[model samples]
Target: MANSDNNNKTAWQMATQVIHAGSGHDDPHGALAAPLYQTSTFKFANTEQGSARFAGEEGGYIYSRLGNPTTHELETRVAVLEGYDAAAATATGMGAIAATTMAFVKAGDHIVVSDAIYGCSFALFSELFERFGVHADFVDLTDADALTTALKDNTRLVFLESPANPHLKLVDIEAVSQILAGRDIKLIVDNTFMTPLLQQPKQLGADLVIHSATKFLNGHGDVVAGIVCGSADDIALIKGTTLKDMGATISPHDAWLILRGLKTLDVRMQRHCENAEKVADFLHKHSLVRKVYYPGLAEHPNHSLIGTQMRHAGAVIAFELDGDEAQSRYFLNQLQMIPLAVSLGDAETLIQHPASMTHSPYTPEARQKAGISDTLVRIAVGLEAAQDIIADLSQALQSSQQRWQRSA
Candidate 1:
């Protein structure tokens, strides 16, 4: 996790890094992938080594909570990809956000958050942190004026998510970083939607990058894990305190599953983008669809940032049907291929109505201002053939039209 010259020498291109970053599998059995060291504790050579490990005098792990080899490998690879000095793995994406934010704040601290984010993330601030004497303000990150008015003297952290959940809104990272350059605020960006492979938030001036490894990072949607990447000092603080005290460490087996997933991230993302582009076009042209919100579309407000900050338009698509919530539910029921599911970034297509499902955690007023209408449908396009995805959606759109065609 050191950012010294020795580490720089090992730095490789991202494709190579995913395969070889900090990978020293010295297992006596010579297994190919990282072996699962699925125990709760590690043994030392002697009592002296244990004392040194505890005192930070030695470099060996004393317990799984402090460190684990398999998890460390995943952390190292993701940190390298994120262009950070180190990383910490957690039980879930929320765990990563909690550990990172809790490490930097306490009672009497104030934080600024994006107006629209993943529902659980909103809950993390409103339901959990606010009860503990911390204060948070949700503001529109796309507007410079809003960002200016939200900053306070006690502001300790500024959290955001670009191409925010359920909506495709862009926050200019460089512009915002310059605004807080002289302040002591830490900018935390949830980079779950755009993996570091697509967008490098560190290069754009973020203090820390958080990810729900359950999403694009794992690509296959088999494991639920989280990672926070930043400087060695910052990562060490979370590992030593928040992660240990909160007991949100990821299991070694899940870490290994995610590690396997990372190896193919680049190719999987390429296919995801390819499939999303075609699906967006189909939705945009459909008579029953009102508006499509994928960044790949030229009409998107943040379309230009896709090529500038990210490698491509991601696989998530948000659109409103020309119907009410009940008609939207009818459309979901008529779908033949895409599953009506909550979580995204799976190998198979998944769809959900956010206003009633994912983003329901937000108050009605908050959800309305964020533009998550009751008829809004969020689709996580998968690796299915473009024709298959389009065909499934087309039939559902037709059914929805028949079910809701009236008065309008």
Candidate 2:
């Protein structure tokens, strides 16, 4: 059972927190697992109780949209993992991004963003934020001078991703945080790739940490969710306004699924890193592979920084093909075991061509600027035996090279 008290989390290690962060949960039926409290509405004892709950004077559920005991369990556990005062879950990973943006900035504000982020995030910043009169500047955050030059007086937030998506470019969270320390700007980190098991952004001075819970926190690939963890005051404002008004709260069942997945996070990540290291080494030696972007590889520019921030090199790897996009697509199509897919962090190894798929939103010029090439292939290495994973990739690369040579 959970302690229901936030302090209880500080006493246990991460592995223990997954099972016990929200443990003191109670149900009329006395079920040990967090009860699903599936209904939409809760009864108020009286007018005073109802008013207090709405006013934030008391803690109780009035509506599932606003709060639910089952969802709260997941929130508490995630908050503890991210080392934040509070967490809010959303209907989907993108919702977390949307809610956080809406909660923080408004018209006339500017944002300095990193170049290597999710495709949808780029769209939200470039398309949606632009329409609202809010401005955004996308720069290679690895270049500290560029980041500093891009910042404007009206810059309301500095958003970044460490070991960024697709290419694995890392932004120095502590360095960036210190730059904003005396300023009024908030520093938000998209911590989806590292998961708290490997890195805690808040501990490194991030004001808020966001996760695509759909990818990792719900590791089974069966649920779609997102989490934003931050100070209690900020989360309360987001919960009451942005999430509530936008109707992006997570479902109780999805929250429970994430809670279940959290239990084995430690073990899963350990294996993921182990398998990824071997797979990266294999790709590096292969003739058809041009370059591999994984922090574990000493060749990776951010290799040293991984040791500074993350516990492991992480599971996803992006590599360029010695051939063109056609060969890359052929390589993906030739894979027998690992499925060609979009989303990452699944129990099964998933691979995809980022140029034609995840990063399709960018034009050829924009893609190059973002460090994504047409021949780039991303592998979300899963928990399969490292040998088998290597075999599948080896055969696929060979097949693609042969086909390309014959065509040439």
Candidate 3:
């Protein structure tokens, strides 16, 4: 049976628990925060005790790579927040994805995934996993029929990312979960875009939820971490095999940083949503913007579904400009406040061109099919004042329009 102390907590309760949960009171030295266990190996109490630990008869740390007190606290906090029985922390987001996928599939198994996942993740599946003899099918996640059609007899996993990176496309978690119910296939969702405060996939019937904690979960963008949350049995299965073999364990210092970020996640998420809404509204009204993709907007194709599934529209927003690569470059160069960078989910605003940046590895046709157009620009709205963000975007758009007129 699962431990009783961590059960029956609601999402709000879990958020509060994140502030004070997991080994805060265990230190005999009366330290308030969990200290980092930086040692490579732990000192065994005795030969019998060490044997017991190795044999799984006792629960204690054997090595920092396998486990650590600080990392365990971060895992426990993430599991509680995500409404899962347990969680495992990894060195990076890709580590979590690779570890989980490796744990669940074998040579003859097949996988189905959303076409609009993070570019790195897409490459990992298409290039690396395919080379390993594991077949993968990618389909537009918004089309339920396509997902169903992609599933095969040997399909062992279905991966999705709601409000997918760069495009901000929405996928109905509950709808997908219902479709895969009672099947051998496990539903794995990349919940990095929408942290636990905004959306909990497990509660909606997903078998597993993964996060690139470097994003919203860490909030500060200082540490790179990943988490996989699910039932105890599934967690133990991955922890015992894939995680142990892959050796992608998160460092104690990084875990501590992530824990610090989690303390104010609720407040940070609210501001991110608010600022993103304002930015989306500004972009929608701009003359240079051909299309704006944001769930908060009523015109979005999945707005209604997003309303039902997500607590908020989220911080990331994407829009297409009227011109080609030249114009897009001019616009990005004109921007003063927003930094031109690849990664998102930071305290300061960031902007990137997906066609030439994050999604550049994919073929042009593949990128277009995934809604990553040559003119597409993605904005990760930060904690900055909404008015200032809008003003900065206005100047950039105006500059792009003037440049386009000159070129024409």
Candidate 4:
């Protein structure tokens, strides 16, 4: 399959390709799976051939860091799924983001980004990009007008995360695209929350789509990987310049793990959506809950926009409790089934207190403005039975309420 030209295949057909796309006929020794080409360098047929490969006159692997048959297969599959001309795999999700950002923008250029992005991403834009003479402004992504207003003459990129981390805030991708349609700006969306099965950002006019494959793409919390999908020109530039110079490339073994994970993504996402809806419904009806933040809920502020942009509501849900930090901590400590941990989109349920755990880096005023209150708790619903998840949450809430009353 590594030798096959996949230019003609449709998207659904590409999912099938995920399993069989990367490997050539098995070795005569009968190895069924794609073997990890684990070496750093590849032997050249001749010096002339190597020169042609290096000069872009031909296509072939020269180094594992540059490209490998196994990683190439994952790249092709992700590209097709994302409806892009090409894709590149990275060692981690941050690697993908950094490579994509560095490829397009440089010193003196400005970036407009969502304020509620992954905490680390926010730190990068705020603390690091400034040191390199690249300026970034963070705004509430849900407000398209604010994003447009924040753009400057030097603004070269707009970075956003929809159904943003922990809070579940939705951004209007199409609206943002329309605002930038005639501008020189490129729109980059971190699509880790929705995956390509639910949201194809490129089809909606994004210039680039990135993912932390450690989440839903891997589906089992096993591998740390990232992917960037976009036009062939964009991918070629990043691959040739940023990726080559930075050396943050995905391992063949990790790529193979992602490939195996991709085979089950469709089915797992279905269950994740179904279970998340049930859990959200439960949270909405609880007496101690102040607000439930899941797009599947009609009361969600961006429900209509989400319906237009995404295939379904994603698995993450956040709710605010009736009290403060102590109440939130009590609930977290009472959970029996859901693990109190960070990182989402896994096989087992996980929960965290965003004000303390995920978004703790933000100043109090910043967290409050982003709606991450001291009482907010976020849940990443998994394949657990809905009844069981709800039951555990109910008990936790009950304990929290009692603790709050005792403290008062």
For candidate 4, report its TM-score. 0.93
Q: Go through the candidates in order and give the C-alpha RMSD of each one to the true structure.
A: 4.1, 4.0, 3.9, 4.5
- Give lDDT tens digits, candidate 2, residues 1-408: 112243224323776876777667877788887787788999999999999998989988999999998899899899988889899999998899899878989899999899888888888888899999999989887777887888888999988888888889878898888778888899999999888877888878999899999987788999999999999999998999999999999999999888888888877877888999999999999888889899889878777776557767889999988877877888889999999998888899999888788888776777888989888889998989999999998888888878887888
- What local lDDT score does residue 186 receive in model 1, on the 0 to 100 scale? 96
Ranked by lDDT from best down, the candidates are 1, 2, 3, 4
Per residue, candidate 4 scores C-alpha lDDT tens digits across 187-245 of 99999999887777887889999999989999898899999999999999999999989
Instruction: State candidate 1's TM-score.
Output: 0.95
What's each prediction's TM-score?
A: 0.95, 0.95, 0.95, 0.93
Between candidates 1 and 4, the lDDT winner: 1
Q: Which stretches of candidate 4 lie over 4 Å from their true place?
A: 1-32
Worst 10 residues of 3 by lDDT: 1-10
lDDT of each: 0.87, 0.86, 0.86, 0.86
